[model samples]
Target: MTAALTVSIVVPILNEADNLPKLFEHLHQLTAKPQQIIIVDGGSIDGSFTLAQSLMTEMITIQQSAIDWQVLASSAGRALQMNRGAALASGDVLLFLHADTKLPNQAMTEIALAITQAKWGRFDVHLDSNKLLLKLVGSMINLRSRLSGIATGDQAIFVRRRIFEQLGGYPNQALMEDVEISKRLKAIGKPACLTSKVITSARRWQQHGTWHTILLMWRLRFDYWRGVSPDSLKRHYYNT
Candidate 1:
C-alpha cells in the first residue's frame, strides 16, 4: 500500500482475460497510485480471476491473500458492479475505468493536477479502429466531451468520492449509466477534460457494423433522454 491519494481507480470485468493484462499494465501507465485499485469481477469462467491474482503479485502491494479483489455472481449488471467498486474504493476521488481502455503514463499526475483545479474530469476517448468513419466518430466524441461533458464509459470519469456519495452514485442500469451519471455530475459542476486520452477497443462496432452500431447507439441515447429504462435499452442491444 503506497501513499493513498484522493483518487481511486475502479474497474469491472466479465470474462475479459485477453484484455486484463493490458488493462493492468495501462493502469501502471495511469496517473494515480494505490488510490485503491478496485477490481469487481462478475463471474469470469476463463480464469480471469486467476490472472488478476497472478498480475496483482507484481504491481500491487497487497498481500497475496488480501488483494483488493471482489468476485460477484454475474447477476449484478454494469451499473451494480460500478457501484460496488465505488463502495470499496478508499480514495476521495473515484475513477471508473473500462477493462479494455488504456491510459497514458502521466495519467495520475494529471489526475492529481486536475483535482486541484476541478471537481470532476474525464479523459478524451480514442478508439483503436482503423476505419475512417471511426476516426470521424472519435472526433465527434471529443467534441461531445468538450461541449456536453458527456464522456462514455470508455472515456473514464473521475470525481471526488464525497461528491459521488452525496449525489447518490450511478443509476443501476444495463446501459446508459455513464450518460445518466455524467448528466448529474455536469449539473453539479463543470468537469475537466484531460489531454491524456484513453484508447478503447472498437470490437463492438467492427463486429456489428459501424453504421448500424452508431444508429443503434443514437436510438438508445434518444430513448434514454426520453426516460427509457436502461435494462430495456440493454435488452435491445447486442453488447461489446
Candidate 2:
C-alpha cells in the first residue's frame, strides 16, 4: 500500500474573525486528522489574527512579518496572500479554501480517496441561502465548473503540491487567479468534483442581491479574460 496522502488546506483571510472559529470547527469535524491547516492573512486588524494564534495546533500563521496596509491598494491581493500560504504548505496536496466556507464531513476522506486514485480536485459548494436567485447563482457557478473547468475559490481547490508549484503558483492579480490556475490545472489534469460539498456563505449575494451579484461576477470574469487590470476590476468591486 502507498503512504497516506497529506493535504495542507490553505485559507486566505482579511478581517474575518467572526467567521474563523466556526470554519475551523467545521473543518476539524469534517476531515480526518490528515495533515495541516495554514491560515494566511492580509494583515487583518480584527480579531482574526488572535483567533489564528489560539488555534495553534494544526492552525498556524504564515508571514507574520508586518505589512503596509496601503500595499493592499496595490499588491496585497488575495492571489498574493494565497501564494504566501502555498509557500508555507508542506502537504502532498494543497487545498485552497475560503475562511467563511465549511466543507462536508466526507471532505478529507473523499479527497484522500480521489488523490489516491491519481485524481485531483476540490469540493463543490452549496450556497447557504433559500432564495431562488441565490440558488440560481449557485447552480450557474457549479455548472460553469463542470462545463468550463473554472471554479471559484469558495468551491475549494485541491492539487498535488509539486504540480501546483510547477505551475508557479497562483497569479499575483487581485482577481481571477482561481480561474486562471484551474485553466492550467485542467490542461495538466482534469480536476474532479468531490461528492462532498462545502457550504459557503451567500452573504455577498445577500448584500448585493442575487441577480446583481451574479451579473457583476460574470462581467468581472469576462473583463479578466479580456485582460482588464485587477486594480480597475477591484475599484468597482462591491466592498459594501
Candidate 3:
C-alpha cells in the first residue's frame, strides 16, 4: 500500500497570544491531522510561545493526544519565520497559516486531496464580520485569486515540500511575501483554487476602516508590481 502524504502546518507569529488559544482549538479538532504543527515565533514579548507549548501539553494530558508541535524562535519577520519553520518540517507538504485564521473542519482533508492534483494552492477566505463590505471584499479576494493565480496569506497557502524547496520558499521581503511567492508559483503551474473558505479575523479591516484598507491594499499591490521595493512599501504600510 502507498503511504499517505504527510503535511506540516507552519505558522509564523509575532505577539499573537490573544489568537493562539482559538487557533489551537481549531487545529486540535481537525479531521485530518497534520504530521506536525510548527510554530515559528518572531520575538514575541507576549509569551505566545509559552502559551502554545502549554496548550500542547494540555492536549496531551487531557486527551492523550499525540500532539507533534514545535515552537521555534527566529528573527522578527514573517518570511524569515516561515522559512525557518519549513526547514524544520518533516512532512511531504507544507501549509502556511496565519495566527488569526481559523480553518474549516474539513480543511486538512481538502488540502490532502488537493495536493494530489496540484503542487500548490490556497483556500478561499471568509472574514469574521457582519458588514456587507467585508463580505464583498472576501468574495472578491476569492474570485481574484482563482482567476489570477494569486493568493493572500489569509487564504492559507499550501505546497508540496519538494516544490517549496525548489522555489526557495517565501522571498526575503518585509511585506507582500505572499504575493511574491504566488507569482513565482503561478509561473510553474496554476494553483488548485479550493473553494472551501477559511474564516480569518477581520480585525485589520475593522481597525483601519473597510474602504480605507481596501484602497490601501490595492495601492500596495500596484506599487509592488510596478517595481517598488518591499522595504519602501513596508514603511508606507505601517506609517498609514
Candidate 4:
C-alpha cells in the first residue's frame, strides 16, 4: 500500500502582525491540516516574530493538534525566507502560503490528490472584497494562470519537496520569484491548476486604486518579460 503523502506549509512573513492571528485561526479550522506549519519571519519590526512564536507555543502547549508548528527567522526577503523554511521542512510536499491568504476547505486533501499526478500545482485565488471590479480581476487572474501555467505568490503554490529541491528552490531574486519558479516547474510538467480558491487580502488594490495597481502590475510583468532586471523592477514597484 502506498503511504499517504504529508504536507508542510511554509509561510514567509514580513511585518504581518496584523494578519497572523487570523491566519492561525484559519489554519486551526482546516478540515485536513498539514503535517507541519513553518512560519519564517523576515526581519519584521512590528513584533510579528514574537507573535508568531507566541502563537506557535500556544498551539503546541494548548491546542496540541497533531500539527507540528515552528517559527524561524530569516533575512528580509520572501524568496530567502521561503527557501530557508523549505530547507527545514520534512514532508513529501511543501506548500508556500502568503500571510494574508486563507486556504479553502480541504486544501490539503486537494493538494494531496493533485500531487499524485503532477509535480506541483496551485490553487485558484480570489480577493476578499465585494467590489465587482476586484471580482473580475480575480477571475481574470485564475483564467490567465490556468492558460499560462504560471502562478503568483497570492495563490497557494504546492510542490513535491524532491522536485522543489532539485530545481534549487525559488530563485534568489528581489521580485518575481514565484513567476520564475513556475516557469521552471512548468518546463517539467503542467501544474494541476486546482479550482479550489484561496482567499487573499485585497488591501493592495484598496490602498492603491484598483485600475492603477492593475496597470502597474501589467507593465511590470511586461518589463520583466522583456529582460528587465528584477532589482530594477523591485525599486519601481516599491517607489510607484
Residue pairs in clash, model 3? none
Clashes of each: 5, 0, 0, 0
Candidate 1 residue pairs that clash: 6-93, 31-107, 31-108, 32-108, 92-161
Task: Give the alpha carbon lDDT tens digit for every residue of 122-227 in model 4.
Answer: 9999999999999999999999999999999999999999999999999999999999999999999999999989999999999998999999999999999999
The local lDDT score (0 to 100) that residue 175 gets in candidate 4 is: 98
- TM-score top scorer: 4
Query: Model 3 over residues 102-218: C-alpha lDDT tens digits?
Result: 887887788888888898999999999999999999999999998899999999999999999999999999999999999999998999999999999999899989999999999
For candidate 3, the lDDT comes to 0.90
Off by over 4 Å in 2: 1-3, 57-75, 117-119
On a 0 to 100 scale, what is the lDDT of residue 53 in model 4? Answer: 95
lDDT of 4: 0.94
lDDT of 1 by residue, 125-153 (tens): 88997889998888788887799888788
Lowest summed-lDDT stretch of 10 residues in model 4?
1-10
Predicted model with the maximum lDDT: 4
Alpha carbon lDDT of each predicted model:
0.78, 0.74, 0.90, 0.94
Name the runs in model 4 displaced over 4 angstroms. Answer: 1-3
Please state every model's RMSD to the true fold in angstroms.
3.1, 5.6, 1.6, 1.4
Q: 1-240 in candidate 2: lDDT tens per residue?
A: 125677777878888889977876765555365466777778888867777667543333321321111111113568888788778777888888898888767676777788865446866678998877777777777877877876779998888899889999998776778888888888887778765678899988888777787778878888988989887888778463
The TM-scores of all predictions, comma-separated, are 0.88, 0.87, 0.96, 0.98
Weakest 10 consecutive residues of candidate 3 by summed lDDT:
59-68
